[model samples]
Target: MVKRNIISVLDMKDDMPQLVELAEKLKKERGNHGEPLRGKTLAMIFEKPSTRTKISFDVAMSELGGHPLYLSARDMQLDHGETVEDTARVMSRFVHGIMYRAFDYKMMDRLGDSATVPVISGLDNLEHPCQALADMLTIKEHLGSFKGKKLVYLGDGNNVCNSLLYACAIMGVDMIACCPAVRMPNAEIMLGAARIADQNGSKILASHEPLEACVDADILYTDTWVSMGDSTSEEVAVKIFKKYQINQELLDIAKPDCIVMHCLPCHRGQEITDDVIEGPHSVVFDEAENRLHAQKAILLTLLK
Candidate 1:
């Protein structure tokens, strides 16, 4: 079994298949009415603002009969001089699990190290494991399986790309990132995905040429050009990522059946065009909805 702390995609590596299967079942059955998390409490901390991440986990916990306490970083004592370890120890005594959407990955690690309860990464600068699981679930729902599928991510390689790369590699999906060399994902993450790919009979490729990476891809994915707290100025980010936008011309280069995806809060006409994002090929909404179910599975698996 994988560890209860989902700090990275690697945390859930061994249970990916089972977790996805549980997500599918929960989605189909509309979840457990018996309330597996009855009387449980989940502490949610948001150091970074969010729409999807905030709503999904709160609702997931509620539907499973758990009370979710939403904590804003500004309102917490942690911002007023308390350490992450101190906060973690305090929260663990009150909650069955903890979910954090943070800007600093190290703080999340510290929280996990100090907490006895399950710790889930709602989102961090380094990875978004829940989104990756939901993404894979969306792919499986649409295309049946990850085996032999090719996924080309077009834009700045950030947290989403990092986790997606690991998820695809683990599932035997050929994963490719199409972005400028300067904006590619962390080398360690790419190397780790490559190692997983080698074991899973999959391939992981990171390249600067969009066309080369998108050629015959079964899935075309992308995220915002300017991630939260990105050091790059907006003008420079736009200038560098403009060429990598997922437009009709780019989609045409992929397989006709290719599904376009974006982990939303999408900047329309930026990383992806409005037409392409709203077009028939887009499964972005499905991906968003699966965030709820996929997270329900995570909460159930960890807290039940």
Candidate 2:
């Protein structure tokens, strides 16, 4: 059988709903499925710092009867001299699968290309597939279906937005990417998502005005203005994104029951306000917690 990879949301196109369904089941009954991955080992390589990604994967593997070996960039030779392909090939012999959170998107591709086992992208500069999975599951829990709801993403059109665009397209949810034109998502991803959206009867919109995008939105989402490997100063990014903050005023423009979401490590007062993040409308913690269940579904799908 061909080894599958979850390097981007596009990778889960046909299996999106299946994964979400599995995630929901796993959430409600964590131990319903006996450990399918007993004695298996997963190698997690982190080229960047993390809180949720690291702990969630570790716990997910443990709960699934697998071991997760956390390897930082400093712990691995990839930073000093080794090539990603060699690292992947070497680890494939010892581990059941590999999950990598890195800066370069191509390195994840290289690992997938070289490794005999499954390769999962925890996060990269281009896309974040796992986060999108959790986001979809969370939306499903709240809104029942994606048929009529609109998800408005505000702030820098970075990796999270890119994956969300793909997820929304595959799941038939209308999505409006609300960000400055200069900070629009990758053109190739937009083109691909647009194709999928067009065929599925879901609209993919890009708007510069937050109010225009948030109008009647069922979900309002945002991410950090400056990401893990981003070089832009917080000061600069804050200024550029000051107008895009998701606060009460912005929430007023959306549906009365609109839910707030952030793929966390939020810059509280910058991309979102403290009140909104801690308010009754926020489900950021649910999104964070679903990471474990959603990723367990991913692991079972790819590894079992």
Candidate 3:
């Protein structure tokens, strides 16, 4: 009887707090696999590859008493040129919900339009809803409240940054994305985030100078320089982004107790240094662990 939430950076200013509250309660009362989704099924489709998005969602479903049908795009009729909408319609007949990790945001939208059941966007070039959910959960756990906390993201302004902008904005967390102009998040996403920030008493900032952004942040985050499906321009990318690396110096500029985070499979020396990532203040593992609990909340919201 619940509705769907597919994209990460929509006008999701209000829904997040309720979800966060639910996820917090769920995490503390672990091992209680509630029967909210005892008879329902979740179909997870991965067009693009992922580690956290795939495992976290699968585990979340099982823990919520729902059966998860994990399938890759290569495993289905879509491999033989079947239309995405057709596949979505057929899957809707069998499953209570669908979750997709795809290259295009439109693919998830197509699936949503075609299916009677709700669809979740596991990831795409534009948004990573589930990942952002986990990020918020991690932030809330560590810093108590994100209000007035500053976060500096020093890497490619890809999907991760795109979603985090909204999550931070809605939670009253200030964000600074220090990346090359070409790599900044989508303009549309930034504009939408401004409205959310205005309503929630937060801000989104961008700058070419990494130190300027990192100076007083409570958290420093980064992602891979080269995204999936982008294989060209290594020399130019290095030339353009070398200044934005999260080394010990930049970390020093941040608050003394500031934590470092990266959504991994990281390139150690490229986006972030070994000393900082392996340092005491690094909470990357906590973020990874919260993926399960946050996903549990999303499934409960949709299928329960």
lDDT of each: 0.92, 0.92, 0.84
lDDT of 1 by residue, 225-257 (tens): 998898898899899998899999989989999
Better of 1 and 3 by TM-score: 1
Angstrom error of the Cα, residue 15, model 2: value is 0.7
Off by over 4 Å in 3: none
TM-score of each: 0.97, 0.98, 0.95
Model 2 / residue 183 / CA error / Å: 1.3
- Cα lDDT tens digits, model 2, 42-110, are 899999889999999999998998899999888888836988778888899999999999889988888
Candidate 3 has an lDDT of 0.84
| Pairs in steric clash, model 1 | none
Per-residue lDDT tens digits for candidate 3, residues 1-304, read 6456566646355688888888888899878766778888999888888888888888888877889998988888852578888998899889999988888888777777788888888888888877787888888888888899999888789999999988898888998878888788888888888788888888888888987888888999998888888774777767877888889899888999888888887888888888888989888988888888888888887787
Runs with alpha carbons beyond 4 Å of true place in candidate 1: 1-3
Worst 10 residues of 3 by lDDT: 2-11
